[model samples]
Target chain A: MAKRQLLLLSSSQLHGYEFLEFASRDITDFLSKNKVSTVLFVPFAIKDHNAYLKKVEKPLNQWGFKVEGIHNQENPVDAVEKAEAIFIGGGNTFRLLKALYDTKLVTAIRTRVLEEGVPYMGASAGTNVATRSINTTNDMPIVYPPSFEALKLVPFNINPHYIDAEPNSKHKGETREDRIRQYLEEKDSCTVLGLREGALLHVEGYNAVLKGFTGAKLFVRDQEPVEMKIGEDVSYLFKDCA
Target chain B: MAKRQLLLLSSSQLHGYEFLEFASRDITDFLSKNKVSTVLFVPFAIKDHNAYLKKVEKPLNQWGFKVEGIHNQENPVDAVEKAEAIFIGGGNTFRLLKALYDTKLVTAIRTRVLEEGVPYMGASAGTNVATRSINTTNDMPIVYPPSFEALKLVPFNINPHYIDAEPNSKHKGETREDRIRQYLEEKDSCTVLGLREGALLHVEGYNAVLKGFTGAKLFVRDQEPVEMKIGEDVSYLFKDCA
Candidate 1:
């Protein structure tokens, strides 16, 4: 049976191997420990495809895992099927969705990650794909497809690159915290995770724990964040009833 | 003297025109009335280049103004100087931004619009390019640029296809009304136009009035929407503050 685990990292270089650096530090360690270094980079969704290609190429090989780069936007369904561990980096989720929809790869990744369980790891947009909805990313409306439900790797939503209120803007605006609160005021029972860099959500079986970071606030409407720590069990994080 | 009047439309087919049928009704009428028989579509940001190519082919010919397409992504910068009345259509603003950023068309368009006084118009993402910050756009993050600012055509943020709340989602989340309010609070002092389909801001000397359709609403924080009609004038919907 394939081992199913998700490594959703914040944007910080992780050691162990370099080719897979743009992902979280904790993620690379998970890969190192599992002895699964070979990886695939999805470039169709990113703006700096060439930059990222160079970023991941060397480190992946250094970590003793073969690295593969897929550039088939026109026929991504094929690229996705042949890959082992799939990493969806951060960029524009809608644009990524549109590209995937255009190439018909959304369902392929869904099948591969959910059904086949080939170790899914994503950072910004990647972590976003794990959620049931992605109405809260920070980007532009290059286009709007009527219905937008994400990859839904997990049941709740994640607000990656979650930031604290800036001193200058704090006096006037609502941070992601405030925004989710508004979302909460309406849907009093939605689980939202506000993650900062160096954070990773490691899921195996019925447990999830925040790994390798701090200041990553987890929020659900109506309830305050249950303070999280690296190496601590997270069954308590999602234990409360909806 | 160059004609400074610009006709910005919502996304759709151009009605009553023999060609370019899939444009907003409001824009087509403005074109018909202004006797503008031709238009040039800058498709630097669109996914399907062929569909856009055919969109402007027919009506522009019918209007008797010869039309051509200038794809910045496919061509060099020297061609930007030859263009006139460049109407950037609505598609994916992020894609367009990517293309513009890639081709340096963002600087070219700003030079053309501001320096040469090219009659400029945009809808949707096209509309977004006219703002100081594309950050307010409700699209997904497939990529992360350092910033989400745009051309600042009117020194205001535009929310086209201004969604309020889906009937099913109406009571379940932060309504669109509440979201922009949060942006206002964050921005503290900036004008935001929740321009509904068919509603537009026609700018002339000291004259920015809401014209065309009636279904639109404009909001500044904590203030009621000041309605729009064919010939009513309003000042900074948020008053002197923004």
Candidate 2:
């Protein structure tokens, strides 16, 4: 099989950065190097369709690629099968996964990306569904999908926008780290890649790498979280993870 | 049905307060008026059994109530059925809900509290599950339960530990308000009560009131969030909520 190409981003924009500014260059290069002309965009995560499309168009247009919202097409599955590349935007994970499942596009997208090697780029909630299950998401469960299962494009799960606790804050809610630790206790076999903002996991077939301006935290069941330096090899996450 | 008696707390402890200190007075008063002796404690949310039981025993004992862990009982359903009062502690909501389903205790607890007039007290995750569903919880999914449907003791959903966005922070993730807004968009009929820390909602039959040190924000579908006074009546939540 052709090496699977996936760019799973923690978020669309980092602190003080313009929309998609942090990952714009990487995204543009990914599309350009592949000689892609148009990319199919999944905007199901956000409720506002016009605003999401407008924001996505400007950046991708600057990168010399045409973008179309899948929701506008006659058949979303057909569109995915024929798309040169696919981009899923960020918003609510439950809504996004439900949309994907509702339209029967999960299998179509998985086949295109994993089997046919179509380029897949997603941010935030979009990045979450690229994993085995949406169980590790930080978003509210505003809506329940058919199941917690996702595309299963990757072996383990991804916790996007992984942030540490506020040092001086006295809030009683559990920190992001504590929530993930509880997740590990329930799911011992699955590993969770805590992708901090401004970082991403890049998968090229069997080899996956931690990339971008910042590092990420890797959490496995029963083990302390290990920090992955930028550019560090994370291919092991793909091993025995699925 | 007997008048429903429930104490849905946002958290067990606030900063600079002992365990259950913030709500200790109200708790003791409620139990005392009911003439309750031994209370059954549901500690399924946390993984550590001993630690949870130890922490709970201290505070309830101070109030002259004997606390027993429901997990230690041979029949959890029978224990809840016979209990004078039930206290569910805070932790991961998903785990707690899943455990309740796995052990078939959801029905037993509901019957005990709703029919038998046994007082139901819960903090954080426990509070989340007392409503129609656990969709408004802040904790990560972590694990999948049989369903997101929760104990329908209350008409509307309770979002515990509900804090506003950091004023000057650079975090790009959605704020608590933004998330609740999205939830309303999807669930227009349901009302969400954002109970801030150091606050709680006390339900007595068809009447519910916001009590404690701080006010709460009520989010209804397509309406601006209304700020509820600390002692304001919230019986409206029980009206059309279901």
- Interface RMSD, every prediction, one decimal place: 15.4, 0.8
lDDT minimum window of 10 residues, candidate 2 chain B: B180-189
lDDT tens digits, residue span A110-168, model 1: 78777877777777766776666665564443433333567766666677766666554
- Write the residue-wise lDDT of candidate 2 on B13-37 in tens digits: 7988988999888898888988889
- In the range A1-242, model 2's lDDT, one tens digit per residue, is 24699999999989878888898778887888777899899999999977898899998888789999898899999999899999999999999999999999999999999999999999999999999999889999998888899998897999999888899999978998898888888844388899999998888898888888778898888888888898998887877575
Clash count, one per candidate: 26, 0
Residue pairs that clash (backbone atoms under 3 angstroms), model 2: none
Docking class of 2: high
**Pick by TM-score: which candidate is best?**
2
**Which interface RMSD does candidate 2 score?**
0.8
lDDT of 1 by residue, B81-181 (tens): 66656677665555566667777777777777666666666766677777666755654333333346677555667776564454542111234565565
True contacts kept of each: 0.17, 0.89
DockQ, 0 to 1 scale, candidate 2: 0.87
- Candidate number with greatest DockQ: 2
- What lDDT does each candidate get? 0.59, 0.89
Judged by whole-model lDDT over C-alpha atoms, candidate 2 comes out at 0.89
Candidates, DockQ: 0.09, 0.87
Whole-structure CA lDDT of model 1:
0.59
